[model samples]
Target: SLDGASDNETKSESGVPEVPVPADDTPEVLNKALSGLSSRWKNWWVRGILTPAMISFFFIIIYLGPMVLMMIVLCIQIKCFHEIITIGYSVYHSYHLPWFRTLSWYFLLCVNYFFYGETVTDYFFTLVQREEPLRILSKYHRFISFALYLTGFCMFVLSLVKKHYRLQFYMFGWTHVTLLIVVTQSHLIIHNLFEGMIWFIVPISCVICNDIMAYMFGFFFGRTPLIKLSPKKTWEGFIGGFFATIVFGILLSYVMSGYRFFVCPVEFNNDSNSFTVDCKPSELFQLQDYGLPPVLQSITVKLYPFQIHSIALSAFASIMGPFGGFFASGFKRAFKIKDFANTIPGHGGIMDRFDCQYLMATFVNVYIASFIRGPNPSKVIQQLLALRPDQQLHIFNSLKAHLTEKGLLPLLEEAA
Candidate 1:
């Protein structure tokens, strides 16, 4: 009887046909269904459980090898690039500019080619030199990148419609800005990873630790807002997250330092046909005696140098890293959107998760270049090996002469 009544209800009472409802699989229906869920349940399901579970899965992959981690970083870079470019497209939707999207993606390709080429040349010099095609490509990578970019520029110029010229230029600027923000920072992140998995792992972990602790503290006792850009961020949460991150960073560094796999830099070993992190750990990873300051002298505090550096890294993650998220918030406010996209169910887009991370990555790269990186003798030796016999001999003689001039020949000879 209910089925017969439903069939009758499908038609108007006057024997006119009724318009059928859209299917349940339609975007509108799906969105409505999602919107029906409570915010608390969605947030808890995604943020509390799914997010951590996903992070743990990623950590397992990272533990397996840096190459896997690098691939993950590349995927994130592409997603972030997509998110930002999509935002730009939406913002400038009124202007129908030709080749804007095409050119934006082309430029991304050019930039990634340049950056990844540099990384491969720098870190896998031996592997590159051994392959005839790779060796040629490595020699002229920048020139080729420049040529590819110029081709895109020419295409953009040729495709420019008369009335939408201004709009095209505006989009060009938008695309470049997105590239800088998304692609450039991701390059630095990979650089940090190559330096040592610890460099990559610790800073990222600190950021995650800070984010979680800040939210916990804020949810329980947030009274004063930290910034207008991010209203939910509170002073109490900031302070709590800071201390927690510092301790977490120190502990993480200590544990990672003990393992050569974590502390050693990722290098390609042609002989092994794979990348390896098997070298002796750096001074930063090794334990070192440090005297306590006057405030802590009474407590008999002695610690490794890395433990001290961990505090600095955590401070950046706790303080400056959140500004990146604040900037992202302001950007979303400008766009009048809730999140970058609905890619991650309740956690928002990949860009939302990575906004703070990109800034942290840039900071870590600069910190490494300024403080952590030194004249890597192994790399120099590899380069020397790749050179012609004449060049290698010249360099060898020059190095020997310099050592003699510096009165270090006896020391070197004795050691040899």
Candidate 2:
């Protein structure tokens, strides 16, 4: 019965003629027309030369400082949110749900308020406590966030039209998922940048390098397809990209490790009315001589510690990072769309460019937390100094009592 149904057959209820679904099971044709030399050259001009030039211009913004970088990330987050929300709107446009767009944007504002509030409270707790208003807000950040979210929920319910109820709920779900994917990850990216620009720059650059090299390698020598999710990707490209990214990551890390600007965590210095990245660099960014294995000892006597970390970073960028892109490809394919948008001539939208970066950001954040991050005593002390005298004394007394109970204070008194 299924085999007898014609492609143009209509559904009984809606009487809408079904659009034929493209067969996804077929082996992709690698020798398509775009594989020709002229087309490839044109693609290279857009994707290779022009794209990198634009990226370099943004890198100048990055070089300016973390403040500029944060602004740029905020702008990018807005653009990406716009692009994704637009897709949802287009998909559900037929329903014409009342206030869906407005509610979606409202939800975005609420989520950003929550996420950025947490970031500020966590990182700039001292600055927040210095001002009475900020101190109050910081203290009640979560409660305020919940209240704002509940307001939006109430608004959405009130705005719901009788006929478009299902569509409105669908859009609501869509908006929330998009917010989680876009907002949450962008916040983590900012966290990575603040940790040290190296965490942000290195991981992102590795992905870019991998993308470029993979494209180049695939263009020339591609034969076997890599995965069904991304038809254009090839085994040759993946292999070439992996090796190239490893070398790039190591060299970049070595060069960046020598510079305090790249190595230092960003901090807002209120005394100077500016942000500062001036501190004794962490060991990861400092040179530590590592002994070579017996086989490699004759070829090279020693290596910097970061070179080993670079291998791991590059491996993730080259291997795991592209899976983000693969996931995006599958997402687009499911929607029967070509790209998220043609915002860039060769690339898609901001979301398209950042899909891999978000995944990389998540990985870098986890890596830092697990391996690099520790209890920051200096930061804790700074926060203590910022508190009111009574509050500071309270904390000090509490700490002393805890220490005394643990028997550490008695040992310290004996030593004194």
Candidate 3:
């Protein structure tokens, strides 16, 4: 079957195998049901049916809670990595290259171990400190990560063949680049998740809303092409998606901000031996009244601070997010292929669905660090708990003296 699949592949002008054009394997039942419709309408129907199914499944994951959602993100990350690497494999016709696939996966594991190790140390510091082996690993996490990466690097060097040096090195670079794109971005997504489910959900929801609204507008009113790479993209869609995403993001943030379950940061609960999302929500999620602009000075508006921030998130999603998709389109064109792989009936592969998401995740992470995140008191307390008793007492006295000088210590004591 492998041989048959390879034989069917198209060769490029350089004699390298091009990725095969993905066959439309729409389910037979859908095909029969839509047989009377034109191909254009048939495609719309297929995407319409499958997109909601995907969205519903996504909501179900969210409802199931963060742990399951995290597992799903990881699985999607792996799938996206596989799709990209598989393309590289076909393009280079490296099936005969010894251990190419194995090495790729090895590198993936090394990087994930490195990223997740840092995450555990940051979020689950207490749990990690309680376990001797985990404590050691966390302390030496960077060293361990570097050593693991070096092992893979050495293996790759050792596996290099005499005449196949160039091709092997190309594949090596390909593997690392894929890791940077898929793993690094997905890691950021998880980081955003721990901040709050809203951080994870609102941005993703904006992107999805933009994508759907863009398609709808373009299908009905496309006149000018937006880019040469993606012929189907139109300015009409771009503009429509932008406005729709902004409104959707604001509304979504408003609704979610009111719920403690959505606004609270995810933290580990040692007593329950599980993760928990319960806290006095930060001011970002609290409603505040604001005087209207000069144009409407007579009116006042009450809004969550996050809703104002959502405009930034949505603006980037609508305006710049499509670039990610365009970049993937250009990559596909270079390889002379259609979709990444028909993993989704009408949506190509998991990577196709996520190209823009990776970009949005990066933006959201940076945005939070820049604008929303403040010095976390919990983290400070955790660090204090890890210090020696004398050191903790020393810092405590310093803080108390400073607060007393500011005339706040007596007030705090009286309140207590």
Candidate 4:
């Protein structure tokens, strides 16, 4: 009876399970070009072609400088938010729900206003003080941001219909989660950029290098699976990518450290009415000699301190960054989707490409705050500039006294 019932169910069209389409997005030209190859090889070719294009786009963004890069990050964040929110809407089948989408976007604007306002107050204090309206905004930015968010909250509550109450709340939770993942992480990325492009670029490049190297190794020599969450991931790929990314990171850091434009923290220049990257290099960017180990005492080594830090960053990118991808994979599986969207040809969506990037951004931000960033002289100067003349004079006298007590004033005076 059981076998007969199983046969009947399998025979029924509605009972048949759906399988995910692996490479449904081949371009017409590529499709024809790869017609002679099997599906596996065709996918490899497609990814190989698109991967470099994405990296090239990244290079172009870097060439455009920090402002353009910031704009691009903002755009990607918004796109990722949209992709996630759209997925939530589709999952809940709440197309008919009123005001959820509007509220989601409104909250996004409020959050951006808050984060960017803080950034302006922190880094562009002179500009804010020069403009009366901006000064006023900066003075009460947090309160205004909270008020805006509250307004969105109230609107969301008012929009709730009786029958749609549960679904509406679920969407509310979904929107907040999306904001947490997309907006907050992107804000950290902008923060990392301000520290230096090296901070922003190096960790991100490590992740990218790992992703590419792992995929290449896996494609060619995968034998054992790495994780059940990502079936295609392999142990060989993991090991190979770790070493590759570490070496890539160290070498890249060495190259970037020599360029002041890449090493200097970005700051607003009051004289030029624009941003500048022209500060003297930090100790991290300076090369230092190290004595060799007992076994290799005959040899000497010189390296930028940043390169040593790169090993840690690269290790995290290779080891932990893939977990972000795995988490995304699990999420997609839960939703019964092959990809986030049909946005990128070989990649799934902008979010698909950026899921691990967001994780790397957060990590870099924390790493800078914890280990790299020091007492910022520019920030201290900015604060002093904002004070009354008497207060500034008081601070100057106090600093002089402190230096004199330490017996360093004579040396400073002589140098001056």
- Per-residue lDDT of 287-400 in model 1, one digit per residue for the tens? 766656887766554455677788889999999988889999988876667677767655677898888888898888888888778898988898789889999999989989
Candidate 3: where is the Cα deviation over 4 Å?
Answer: 1-17, 404-416
Model 2 regions more than 4 Å off = 1-38, 297-302, 382-416
Worst 10 residues of 2 by lDDT: 4-13
* lDDT for each candidate structure: 0.81, 0.81, 0.91, 0.87
Higher-TM-score candidate of 2 and 3: 3
Using all chains and alpha carbons, the TM-scores for the candidates as numbered come to 0.87, 0.85, 0.93, 0.91
Candidate 1, superposed: residue stretches over 4 Å from native = 1-45, 294-302, 386-388, 411-416
Best of the candidates, lDDT: 3
For candidate 3, which ten residues in a row score worst on lDDT?
5-14
Q: In candidate 2, what are the lDDT values of residues 140-215, reduced to their tens digit?
A: 9999999999999999989987545666776888899889888888899899988888888888899989988998
Candidate 1: worst-modelled 10 consecutive residues by lDDT: 17-26
Give me the displacement of residue 15 in model 1, in angstroms. Answer: 48
lDDT of 1 at 307: 75
lDDT of 1 at 157: 85
lDDT of 3: 0.91
Give the CA lDDT, 0 to 100, for residue 287 in model 4: 93
